[model samples]
Target: MADQQDELRALLKDSGEPTLERAIAKAREMVDRLDNVTLNIAVTGETGAGKSKFVNAIRGLQDTDEGAAPTGVTETTMEPTMYLHPTMPNVNFWDLPGIGTPKFKAETYMKDVKYQNYDFFIIVSAGRFKENDMILAKEIKKKKKNFYFVRTKTDLDVTQEAKKGETEEQTLQKIRKDCVENVRTLGSPSVFLITSENLARFDFQELVNNLERDLPDNKKYALVMSLPVYSKESLEKKYNTFKKAAWAVAFASGGIAAAPVPGLSTACDVAMVVPFLIKCYYSFGLDDGSLEKLSKRVNKPILEEVKKSSLVSAIADKSSLATKIAAKLAVAGVVESVCSLMPGAGSIAAAGISFVTTRSVLLEGVKELHRVAEKVIEMAELK
Candidate 1:
């Protein structure tokens, strides 16, 4: 109980998970289930700016044509269209209709689109960032939130311009500068050039990296883990974060020690925790691009975490082996009452401590997950 109290205090310090005592008690009850997390992305731009296409690209969806909120010359999307995360169902991309078309008033337009629900905004444009974009950028900045400019259709535009006889170097340089210059109109704009057709081109990797880097450690870790592996660096970074997050989750779940039943701690994890992690990923903005990439790397179908009961089962089964032992050792108070308790072993308490405890067992699991992800990342190189 004392051990559980300590862990609860630690996990609840900044967790915002109600209260530590109640949380633990509740967690103990949820060993068989999981929770939820939600991430929201907003796409907005003038009509014909390819916001919908960009959304589809980031999501690894085929095309944003028909039944996809429309991506043509005319403003096919009259009102905000919300696309649920193809993989992580809880996460969503809000296509906040077109804003640069005629008669766009910032305040009313934002209201019409229900702007408050989004976690961040991506203002996309095909040609150049416009005055309407800058005005909204200013408003977003003033609101103390985040926004990114996605220069859509970079593949077509750059290819056409370069084919007109400009050297590849000159064409690339001109386009880069042009995008930068256009975004400069808005205060502190970081432009990401991308093509919905081929996310491998332009700055899709850069954009994803920046988004992860700009967040807090936990958030960055969550975001990175949820995203697909675009490069070796991305794979490695995500592995590092996943390892860290796994450790953190273990650290938080350590309080399972307080539960009276030997494996009852399992219930706390299955119910309150494992779900919390999946939810955390969603809330951290899990999407199809990330899941699809993860699937490709893992060589398995990637479903939204919400639909991943099999994953929960796997986690429970895998973790049960370790947690049952941890709880048993805790119940026995094997550490304090031992220096000579390990039959004939020296520093028996230390030896037992080395084997049990949240940090040690969890460290092994984290390493295993990392190893698997790294191997998968390596395999992708060949394919």
Candidate 2:
């Protein structure tokens, strides 16, 4: 009770509103925005610059994945094709047509692609940064949007240089220096060296960090939540974001009584709790498809390893069972069943549970998911 009160008070303070009703409205708005905010990222470059692969990677899909952006040495994208994130449909990555061709001027290309639609732009280069890439950066700058220079296929360079007796670090530093010097005229914009096959390697993390730093709070939240949990650092960051969000969810669910039950209103609380945890489960890469993808990528039976967790199994099972029932009953039943099955979820029954009890249950679910996610990261050797 005291903890809920403290959270409510903090929420009210953050809301900057004097009245409880207004504060609650603001809180609900914040939660809604966090869940439904639209983030559009633009990826543009010359033909065969690995832009399509980068688009697929940012959306957590492989080139061969069902809805992955088409990749080839030939120019595959003819228009601005918007690929929605598999889980987060609101976050879209626009694969724009390549610039610097005989017909497409950099300035004209920006206008043709509708530059105003995206939150930011990423100009990719497979080898040396070209003059057209710099021109596009300046055009994006004039439009008042952020643009990043990404040099892809760094892994190939490292592999080829190894045979020449050049250290990986030496090769990386030389490439970075060369990329920087090439773009020195553009105020020495940072160039991220990356390989689509493995986003955890090279400058991908640095690129994500820069995006997180520069994006607006809501868009950044969407970006973070939508990204694949590839490393311990990323998993921990996602966990902390969920941890911070727990209070808002608790307040939102606890305050809104959806239906009048015998002892308490569990419907709305369950409604919010179930989906939030499910999103966490998917975001942590605990879902079947994501696990299968990871297993194939790393050649490890990761799905079987993660399924060993009782909590994970419970969540996955309950999520499967949930789709058959109506929304309220689905989550409500799942809550009770999960609590009964998983020792980590505590001993709270779904019936006759008050707001505080519901909040506690939700927190327990989040913690259990976090633990399973951490274990998966360790087992997969993702750091």
Candidate 3:
């Protein structure tokens, strides 16, 4: 109780709310904004440019995975198709129609796709950039929006060039030089060389870094959380994002006592905490599906190794509902255990859980998940 009062006083002072109620209300509003931020990405390219495959890869899905954007030699996206991120629904990828087609002219492509709705655009091409791509890039620029050029199929290019006695580095440099020369008319914008087969290789992470620099804070958070943990760096990005948001989540969940959840014995809202932790579970690639995929990719028994963590095991066991119930119990147990260890925390009632206590649980949970994710990355040897 004393801890709660002191924390509330600090919040009120820092927030300049003049009252505890106002401070808590402002904190909830901040949390709400973080939870609801949306990002709509527009991907445009010529037909057979591998745009659909790139879309699926960015969303952490294989080409044949359920809900992946359709891909083929011919145009598969005739209209703007929105594919929601499997975990972060607010982050959407819009696969726009292929440019330079008779039906969809490059000049009119942005208008046809309602370009105003998207945050930015990515112009993808399997080979050299086309005139239509340049035209579309200019159009997007004229509209005061950002667009990036992506050259795909670098893996195939590398393999084919290897048969010609060219080194991998030579082939990559040649491709990059060709792409830059082709788009030199657009002031030589950086063209990301990528392969949907393996995002950890080549310049996918660099593309992400550029996006992180360009996007607004809310949208950046959504993008970071939505992307797959392909490497240790990507996992660390997720860990930092979650760590930064922990205070807001804790305040929102513990500021007021909500209705008791099924298994929670504490005042902290297990409902809020469960979803946040589960998001971390998926974002950090600790879920069963993610682990299974990694395990198969690395030809190792990673799932079993990761499931050794009780928190992970609890969140990943059985069906989704069962998992949620188990996660709630596990989180409640953590809260109880944490409270027992904190001096004077045992005297606090269900309605009086301090923000400090909730913050500790959330940070600790995120830290543990991060450690497990880092181990997975190390075991898989993902660069």
lDDT of 3: 0.78
Model 3 steric clash pairs = none
- CA lDDT, every prediction? 0.55, 0.75, 0.78
lDDT per residue as tens, model 2, 1-383:
34544654565576588866565466578788888789999998878889999998887788998899889857644768889888877889988877866556665877888888899999999998888888888888998999999999899999999999999999999998898789899889899999988888998989999999999878888888889987888888888778777766665563444543332234335567667878888888888888888787778888887887665676678654333222333354434532332222222222212334455656677777888788777777887
Instruction: Please give the range of 10 consecutive residues that has the lowest summed lDDT in model 3.
Output: 343-352
lDDT of 3 at 46: 75
Please give, for residues 18-122, the per-residue lDDT of candidate 3 as tens digits: 754565577688788878999999988877888889999888787777788878857644778889988777889988887777778776777888989999999
Steric overlap count per candidate: 18, 0, 0
> Which regions in candidate 2 have their CA more than 4 angstroms from the true location?
1-11, 14-16, 259-268, 318-359
Give TM per candidate.
0.63, 0.85, 0.85
> Per-residue alpha-carbon lDDT of model 1 for 283-327, expressed as tens digits?
222333444555654476543432333322244344653344334
How far off is model 3, as Cα RMSD? 3.9
